[model samples]
Target: MTDATLAQLDALPTDELRDRAFALARQRRDIKFFWDLFTHVTHSDDNTQDGWIGSLDASIDDAVALWREVTGHHYGDAEPLVRAAFIDYIMQHGK
Candidate 1:
């Protein structure tokens, strides 16, 4: 991608950044991207306390939260690194 394209992508709103990266992942059947997203979300904070890893329901909830985040329906704003992850993924794969 050109520098201008990169600039444009960087210039997008955080929600739009998430949307574009997510749409690209779905369109390409990129399971790795989704996995990466899941990992990023789950690991964003110290959510591993109190047997967080042992519950399938918790995992599902996290997945749903991730979906909401990507769809711009999340209750809270994403973290800086999570937002950077979206931009970095698009920079690497959207080119």
Candidate 2:
């Protein structure tokens, strides 16, 4: 997502965030499943996994920044599980 899009999403109400999260989660899950299947079929090594981690870390930074901007709360005290899940999704599926 673009920074503008992320900001728009962040500006949404809490209920909208929940709904958007659900939609994003479904997309993330589908992508992860397909990526896993492809990797299994190709018998790829896990050595390339760091790329995904790096992408996910970038995503986490964006998310944390958005959360802080919208909610006026430090990212450190934000919901850890949600942050972790987002990171996990990116790590598993990001290109």
Q: Pick the candidate with the highest lDDT.
A: 1
Best by TM-score: 1
lDDT of each: 0.61, 0.40
lDDT of 1 by residue, 57-87 (tens): 4443364455575435442454566678778
TM-score for every candidate vs. truth?
A: 0.58, 0.27
lDDT of 2: 0.40
Give the least accurate 10-residue stretch of model 1, judged by summed lDDT. Answer: 52-61
lDDT of 2 by residue, 1-95 (tens): 32334345445554445344435545554444323322332234365343442343344335434334443432233334344444444434433
Off by over 4 Å in 1: 1-5, 44-66, 69-78
Output the lDDT of residue 10, model 2: 44
